[model samples]
Target: MRIAMIAAMAKNRVIGRDNKMPWHLPEDLRHFKAMTLSKPIVMGRKTFESIGRPLPGRHNIVISRNSQLSIEGVTCVTTFDEAMTMAGDCDELVVIGGGQLYQQLLPKADVLYLTLIDLDVDGDTVFPEWDDGSWQLQNSVTATNDKGLQYSFNTLFKKC
Candidate 1:
């Protein structure tokens, strides 16, 4: 199965603060939903909690070590490998994040779907840094929201 990651990060690579995204970009959210629907999504427990619920039309696999933790409409696992095993037979799985999960899975990803926000906001959480030389940019679409937040949707494929 193909493994991909989907995330929106600021110019400083900040992805979240206080367990929530620091920006309000509805267009980016819509794009994320459109791209991830009907696919299996693997994320850390914190990421799942930040979202507050299972995303519709997709298998929600949350990685956590808390064995007793259970939530309706979500599957909890102790490791990233377990999450992948649970995803079983899928054509593609999207690694939706909370920093550590992104870092851990970056090496295995075949593609990355990123929304590069123009603002450089302060945040405690960040996306993991990777060498740009390892991935080839496939496409990009620049857009501006009603609030004047500028961003670009970019797709990159890992070089062979």
Candidate 2:
């Protein structure tokens, strides 16, 4: 399986605030849905709760230490390794996250599909700092939505 990250971050690497996205970009949301459809997506418990339910047409694998917590339609695991094992045979393992979950699995990912939003706003959850030295940009495309939100879709690959 190919592990990958799919997230939207700001210039300051801000991902969320109080369990909600800091920005509103419909195009990016649609792009995210398009890319993740029919794939197995791994996410932290917080991220899963933020969305309020399991995303349809995909397997929802959530990471959390609370063994007693149960979410309908989601397979819950305690660690990143467990999540990996549960996603066996999946061609693509998409990491959908809040913050800490991204930090834990970013190193294991082979590719990153990042939506770089242009604005920076106050946020509590932030994406972990990655070692750019070990990765290279594969491709990018800049676009503006109907709401005038400027964003870039960037793909990065680990330097092999």
Best candidate, TM-score: 1
> What lDDT is obtained when candidate 2 is compared to the true structure?
0.90
Each prediction's Cα lDDT score?
Answer: 0.93, 0.90
What value does the lDDT take at residue 47 in candidate 1? 90
Predicted candidate 1 versus true structure: per-residue lDDT over 27-131, tens digit per residue: 988999999999999998899988999999999999988988898999898987888899999899999997998998999999999999999999999999989
The positional error of residue 32 in candidate 1, measured at the CA in angstroms, is: 0.7
What does candidate 2 score on TM? 0.96
TM-scores of all models? 0.97, 0.96
Q: lDDT: which candidate is best? A: 1
Error of 1 at 73 (Å): 0.9
Error of 1 at 87 (Å): 0.8
Report the poorest 10 consecutive residues by lDDT, candidate 2: 98-107
Q: Model 2, 1-160: lDDT tens per residue? A: 8899999999998999999998888888898999899999998888998999999999999999898778889999998888889888889999999698788788898999999999988999988888999999999999988878889999999998
